[model samples]
Target: METASMSLLHALKEVLSEQQVTENQTVRELHGRDESYHKESLPDLVVFPETAQQVSEIVKLANKYEVPIVPFGLGSSLEGHVIPYEHGITIDFSLMNKILEVRESDFLVRVQPGVTRTQLNKELKKYGLFFSVDPGADATLGGMAATNASGTTSVKYGVMRDQVRDLEVVLADGSIIHTGNLAAKSSSGYHLNGLFVGSEGTLGCFTELTLNVYGIPEHVMAARASFPSLNDAVEAVVSILQAGVPIARVELVDEPSMKQVNLFSETSYKERPTLFLEFHGNEAGLKQDVEFTREIVEDHHCLDIEFETDNAARNRLWEARHNLAYAFIHGHPGKKMMVTDVCLPISELSGAISHAREAVDLLGLPGGIVGHVGDGNYHTLLMIDMSNQDEIEKAEKFNEQIVLYALERGGTCTGEHGVGVGKQKYQQKEHGQALHVMENIKLALDPDNLFNPNKILKTKDRG
Candidate 1:
């Protein structure tokens, strides 16, 4: 190791145990990249801090040495959120995985940052409760909060921001602060929870989180509706929402994605534009809602609708939707996946998606569209050989076109996928003067740009 790297390692080892710190090439390489197709840049060292105090001490040491600190969770992020591009210290939170307390009465849970969604849900199952933010990946709760992630259930349950009741975050200078409280609502000072939830670690590192959970519905039903065209499926969703159908989850999978799912999951779903729908409530109420939804979809020329009430069948239906991204990755052996996420107003969603499909076809790329369309968010999954400059350029153009369409219609470049390095360029265009306010917040919280530098916002220098 170089002198500077050795010095930093020694300092980290002093704060954490030798077992908690590593300079192994394999470990560094794993920490250097995320699920995104973005290029990787390895960190100098990786540390597994097991407590908030340990995280705070490590941050203090990094500040003392004038080095960057990137907080890492499961590294399942799709926008380079966990990649330590600055080659400094990457704090891996895996060791801190623990569900500390379950406030069953209050419908809340306190957990360490490394607690994954699957792990937490398994525990919540025993309490007849569940965490609603299911971002497809079994991402850590801390990482989900960092990205303000939302998924299928968000249509009814709201996003991660809504689920987060409190966050125990370690600031850039090693100070610990709670952004919220257990109270359901409060006229509190400066809604820090809102500010930090989607800050994407550009603000601080989360150590512990207190989140609101929900009781599992008394009755749950899952259904699949196939439409003749993508436009018809999306329009059905819009009408369902307009009529107040109270959908628990509604996801759109284009024909191409449906084929990928059938191939990967070993199922014989009809290869067509499909809407995976879910309902939650009493059986009688859900039946009424389901009937209304069926009528609405039928009006939009839905070819066929199938309902699944059995646990096994419901799991299989959602699993197919959740595994769509991985299926695309599996289909393209030597290519990396680049997913474009943009959300528009409900009335404009059909047009936005239509434009996106046209752009993908024009670019002549192997891509498919899928989304949690109940909330006007969608993604075009593209597989590209990074070495092929022409393909990469075309993919970039396709993403730009989709983002531009959304922005022009008062939509966001990214709805759930937080602005890591990927969506930074659209910040100024989307937020306008508000981007300056965000920059000021970053400067005030992390003046030295030590936390996840070059993410979310651009800085002239690391210093």
Candidate 2:
């Protein structure tokens, strides 16, 4: 086995620079896991491919050797999407990180998959534009697109799929193809861009992407609204959305999560259910929206509402929210974090969240609840000691209960966190006959199941 592994490594080095290919134990360990609680497994080898042609060649080698190929970005995914559990070759795209072209007038930027959300935004800022799909982890664009990630601003702008206009993909057979064109909308062929966005690397490796960008809004206002209860916070979001305030972002961080934030961030945030809110529009329009939003929150029995007046202050507000997971991890020493998110219709969100809170309390888990709740999606963060089987079982039960509850109410098992291994069992229940069509599509695109095998569409080996 060691000799065969060396043979594969030598073959990979032949295709690229020797420095770009490594089988070092440390590098393999880093590529094995993602930001989830799933068991991590190291790939036998790791390859850094700097071009679409390089990616194509690597995929061809994987197919020739029947070794699984898993595409990796920044390893920020929360649902174990990038883990090379089957242990083959992991393609790391960090060297391919570059901003290729910025078509400012066209509101499109073409970039390599290795470019990150924050990095792309930094570059786009010079052009008076910004990429709106922020999954909050500084995740790579390819990984974000793989998971179809959306974040706080999704309520107004849209998800990752909405931002991606076209994709340059290398398929299972090493054929490079562009899934879509630069045109705004096309009826010319199958909507491959959308189909591939959430496929979770089960289809092909994305090499380059043409994405839609938006001009920075004229006026931006951010606030934190503390509510008396979790239900109150969620209800206020539904009311705000229904009222059409053109809210750019509204997040729900429950009471416990607020405590975690205060502890980890060294801020005396109110130890109660809170909603982080942001509005983008004209100055006069934002003023009116802020006034109206204040009224709505007050109607929902908001305790206190405070607005961040400057860019630094606003960034601090969202930064604290984005770091909520890290806050929980910091608070729970030497414990793994289990996060589950569900999406319900706005009407069903309050009840769903209430149920989640109850389940967490009932299970006696130390955790927090924070979410991109403006779009009826929320995440529950639970800290579990890996050695404690009882705690793991209870956490699994908690996850199952919430997923079943949401599914019964026309909610999905996940909203932003893609269906990696953790959520595969729920796919059939969630999609029913539609799941079969997805299977057919997967088989059609990746016949040998060599591309990120056993991820979204589970194979019998893992199941």
Candidate 3:
């Protein structure tokens, strides 16, 4: 470590308990990389702070010494959002995991940055409420908000940004601020909560968050529908949304992914393009919606559709869909998983997914296409052999082709995954002059470029 780096390290040690500070190689390695295949850069030291004040103190010390600091949760980010590329200190929030408050009547929950969605849901079960934004990873709430994550449930309950009601943030100059209030609706100030939630730690570190929750639905139903082709599956979802089916969740799984799901999950689900559908409401209302959804799918030439009202059966259905990524990882022992996320308009989703399948085939890569088609967002999961540079290049080229296709048709390069180095290049093309405004915000909030350096905007003086 350099003199300044070592000095900052010593300062951090003095500020916190000795057990909270460590330069252990094993711990640093664990903090080095997230779930992404992006190259790892280990941190010089790791620190555990159990309170927002401690996080504030750490931020002050980092700014004082001109050292970079990155906030880490469970390291579940897929685009390298948690990786400490600048080799500074990592503030792992695992130790701070706690449910701060559950305002049951208000349908809101206040939690520390470390609480995971499943963990919160388990607690909310007692109150007959649930936190709804599940990104399929049991990811930390702070990590989810940083990436503005969404999943199958997002088609109904909405994404992380929509759930966040307030944020207790520690800024670059050690000043703590709240971006929003406890009210359900407000036009009082600038949408700071909106700006900070998806800023990917470039703005500041979120210590505590107040979020919206929902009461458990009176009736819940899930189904799986198999289609002959990918376009048919996507078109069915679009039609379902168009016909006002009020779907709680609608996910598309291509035939190739369905095969992987069967192989890994040990279930004989039809190895064809499939749609996972769900409805949440009172029993009578759900019955009407289910019938309407069935008619819509049959109109689009669905091969076979089955519905499950049993809770265990519904759980099994989603568990397989959520495990698709791990299925690929388990099947390919030595390879890495790169999932390309792109979202387009509902009118263009069918074409976009078809183009994605052709690109994967044209590149001769082993990949699967799946998505939350209810919201016009989809992903191409590419399994790459890391040792083979040629395969890696092909996978990257496949991503570029799909991204360009989405951009050309009024879609985003990434739907849920934030611009964590992987999607930074397209920020200019996507945002154009608006990119300059983001850079200005970065420079104004963190002029030293120390907060999660080289993420999102790739700001001034970051070279």
Name the best candidate (by lDDT). 1
- For lDDT, candidate 2 versus 3, the one ahead is 2
Total backbone clashes of candidate 1, pairs 3 or more residues apart or in separate chains: 0
Q: What is the lDDT of candidate 2?
A: 0.92
Where's the lowest-lDDT run of ten residues in candidate 2? 454-463
List per-prediction Cα lDDT, in the order shown.
Answer: 0.93, 0.92, 0.90
Q: Which stretches of candidate 3 lie over 4 Å from their true place?
A: none
Q: Tell me, what's the RMSD of every candidate?
A: 0.9, 1.4, 1.1
Off by over 4 Å in 1: none
Each prediction's TM-score against the native? 0.99, 0.98, 0.98
RMSD of 2: 1.4
Instruction: Name the candidate, 1 or 2, with the larger lDDT value.
Output: 1
**Clash pairs detected, candidate 3:** none
lDDT of 1 by residue, 1-463 (tens): 8887788789888889989999899999999999998989999889999999999999999998888989999999989988887889999999999999999999999999999999999999999999999999999998999999999899999999999899999998899999999999999689999989998889999999999999999999999999999999999999999999999999999998999999999999999999999999998999999999999999999999999999999999999889899999999999999999999999999998888888888888899999889999999999999999999999998898889989999999999998999999999999999989988989999999999998999974875
**C-alpha lDDT of candidate 1 relative to the true structure:** 0.93
Off by over 4 Å in 2: 460-463
CA shift of 239, model 1, Å: 0.7
